[model samples]
Target: MEEETDTEEEKLLKRQRRERKELQAKIQGMKNAVPKNDKKRRKQLTEDVARLEAEMDERHQQEVEHLRLEISKQVEVESLANGIGKLECEDGEKTAQHSRPTKAQKRRDKKAALEKEREERIAEAEIENLSGVRHLENQKLGHVLAGRGLQIKQIPSDGHCMYRAVEDQLKERGSMLTLAQLRSQTAQYMQGHVDDFLPFLITPSTGDVYTPEEFEKYCDDIVNTPAWGGQLELRALSHILQTPIEVVQADSSPIVVGEEYSSKPVILVYMRHAYGLGEHYNSVEELKDRTTEIG
Candidate 1:
């Protein structure tokens, strides 16, 4: 029975590890699809990873607790039987002393202690890896831009960074669209094509699909408020402008939205941690000279 229980515990741990590995692979795929410099996306991913780990740990704890209880009951039964035999042999004059822990119990306790230590080490290593990735991405962004003879043109960290970056790109192409105009047009486009955009609109508080009314309010926020723009807004802008929008980030190749609209693409740099605030976008301009410092 002890060996059988040990085998079950080992199987449970292996299954847990496999599930975690699959989840991490899925998260990495998501990271690849989007810009790595998206602070919000990275934060969301981190939270998801942490949540998953916590859940797995909780489940393992519960299972171990259950197993411990079963073992304790078995030990009590065996000790009771042994006590009866000793009492009978001594003709009821003496009682049985408490039994020492079995070899199997000692081995199980040691294994559990070692497993906990391993988990703690793994968690610490994961935290360090996340920090290292953030630092490496910052350095890689500079190298990526320099290789292309382009440099980041800083945009204000206001909620309108995406629009402002687009505005800067439009100006270079002799288009005089202000950020306000871009915001308004993007909102209007999304409103007119509700079928296309409404499905993607989610109510953050409920984590549910947005109702038509909620979707309208979202569009209103886009036009009137300083709500940050993201992939959805980028898609609307790309369609409205009839141009492809290319987003360059540190850890991945450029992500181009609306490629079918035009061969020429307006480019923007995505910074994960450039400003201390959060995710941000900036315009890219040609390097004045090789001597120009990469910001």
Candidate 2:
């Protein structure tokens, strides 16, 4: 009887343990099953925490860098800029009179002064004394035509003279012949006379001005050959002579550069009288009236 009782008790204990395990599993599953909406909320919270951490790290780094830079800037015995009177001089001239400005500020001030000075000087140009290249017969800017023709009063040979070509072309073509046309024709004729030029004068960079050999070689290239044709564009030549060159509108005599005035342009011949290389005048109107004599 006792054995049967003991077996019964064992069976009862097993059943209770199984029920406890099932109850525990049910409670765990209930806890794990979250609402669908809460999952997104938890994920957003995690992401926000991570982002805030990153921003805080970045802010800390920026603060550290700012402090370090401030310290370095404050530590300098010498200037950080180079443009104005330098912190250390090459000539070793020390100035006790001048108050020390930051290197950058000093440079900016110095630049402003220099630009102001240049403007003042340009503004103060003595137009009366300004003149063109001294042509023989002391050709003033206002010389009248006598049909005597241009001769090599200066430079190269009398035969290779450009002054005559200019005069001849000007007289026949009228004073309105564009500067570019004159440059082109002058080069074309000169190269025609000298047949040995190698590289053609299709593009006129500052390639051969100082040397005679390069000049002759280029002369033969562009102008010497009858096979090349009558004349490479004469107007192109005149435009090439002036660096930082300006052109005037056909309707107006206003000086125009890259963006000083209009952007759209019809490339016309450079009018020689347009630029006052021969004289000085502040305005184009001054150039027209006071600068040149029509007679």
**Tens digit per residue, CA lDDT, model 2, 137-165:** 23322232111121112222212223223
How many clashes show up in model 1?
0
lDDT of each: 0.74, 0.35
**Collision pairs in model 1:** none
Which candidate's lDDT is highest?
Answer: 1
Superposed model 2: Cα runs more than 4 Å off? 1-107, 126-128, 131-218, 221-295
Residue 146, candidate 1: C-alpha displacement in angstroms: 1.8
Q: lDDT by residue for model 1 over 46-93, one digit each (tens)?
A: 545544443343344445456556867987998999899777867644
Q: Tell me each candidate's RMSD, in Å, in order.
A: 16.6, 39.8
Angstrom error of the Cα, residue 81, model 1: value is 74
Worst 10 residues of 2 by lDDT: 278-287
